[model samples]
Target: MSDPNPSPEAFRQMASEYIEVANRQGQDAYVGAVATAMLHAGARYAAFVAASNSPNKTQMQLSRKTNLDQITAQFRTYLEGHYDEHSENYDSYIKR
Candidate 1:
């Protein structure tokens, strides 16, 4: 999705939909919600890196790929880097 297309409200709506789906579906809904959320979150993260003029898109992408808490002690932590932070990342370990 393009930066101009993803308004703040759209982001909020995506995040909200993830939660709503998860709640309605319970643990069973986690996989789908997390995956969708992670992609969305990753896209936003990549955009940030792009806007910040990051010299390392690969690293930014890798940073966006890994679990936040798993890498927190290893790398500076931020949102989208973790499961809960990226509710769509069902396979990643979420920070408690």
Candidate 2:
């Protein structure tokens, strides 16, 4: 399916609905859902930056490839280190 390009208000509403559903599943579920959402958001943000600022098609592709690699590495690092000395705070990983 094609991704929906939601308006800011629509995005807020969808987030609220997702939060409600996640809340019903308990804290861990909510945290996991939020973490997943953040990972996707980071990727989308990177893609947007790559698309918007690159001067040409070749540069755009290069930017996107580099951004994807960096984001994936960062996400993997976050996942691996998230439980160390900071298992109590998901924000620590998010902040990274």
Candidate 3:
């Protein structure tokens, strides 16, 4: 017996599904990746917003931490490794 969702890819798929919905009126892929992590995998409520004319992510939820700490650690690793929007893996996951 095993936990099916113990892997990051599994979490990614689940979170990506939620993100497809999130993207209906949502953020672009980079921040969307972060948002998906925050919302689904991290299992925490998240809000994504940009500062006035700031192209960079200058205002993110830095202080808060997910109660699901293990999932959050894995999700953060997944995020750093796959930050590029054009990555085929990410695109596939995002569309799925």
Candidate 4:
């Protein structure tokens, strides 16, 4: 079984792996497209997890909005933090 809660280092490592894969897609893949794919994959996986953890279809249906809200809120927070961090180096990043 996977750890219920991974350490911060482990979380960063996982994120790095995803970034590596996105980078490996080469110049042909637009950054926006890659980001969209990642977002879709995250939402798909979250839905699967929610369904798996629910006792039944009715429970899953009942909790769908709450689950979605929680996931999106977490994503918003993380995105905002990272956006701020990157904004500090926007010029250098844009030049790359």
lDDT, each prediction:
0.60, 0.71, 0.54, 0.90
Candidate 3 local lDDT, 1-96, one digit each (tens): 558447888877976886586566455457656665646633533223112223444333332343236446766986776675447567567565
Q: Candidate 3, which ten residues in sequence have the lowest lDDT sum? A: 44-53
Please list the residue runs of candidate 3 whose C-alpha ends up more than 4 Å from where it truly belongs after superposition: 1-13, 27-41, 45-69, 84-96
- Candidate 1 residue-wise lDDT, 1-28, digit = tens: 4585688789889779866865665566
Q: Write the per-residue lDDT of candidate 4 for residues 1-96, one digit (tens) a residue.
A: 899799999999999998898877646788889888888898899899999989999999999899989988999999999999889989987775
Off by over 4 Å in 2: 1-29, 87-96
lDDT order of candidates, best first? 4, 2, 1, 3
TM-score of each: 0.29, 0.45, 0.34, 0.90
lDDT score for residue 29 of model 1: 55
Could you give me the TM-score of model 1 versus the true structure?
0.29
Stretch of 10 with least lDDT, candidate 1: 71-80
Report the poorest 10 consecutive residues by lDDT, candidate 2. Answer: 21-30
How do the residues 1-96 of candidate 2 rate in per-residue lDDT, one tens digit apiece?
545698889888976885586566556556776767766776787678667767888887767667778767877885777557476775764566
* Candidate 2: residue pairs that collide: none
The number of clashing residue pairs in model 3 is: 0
Ranking, TM-score, top scorer first: 4, 2, 3, 1
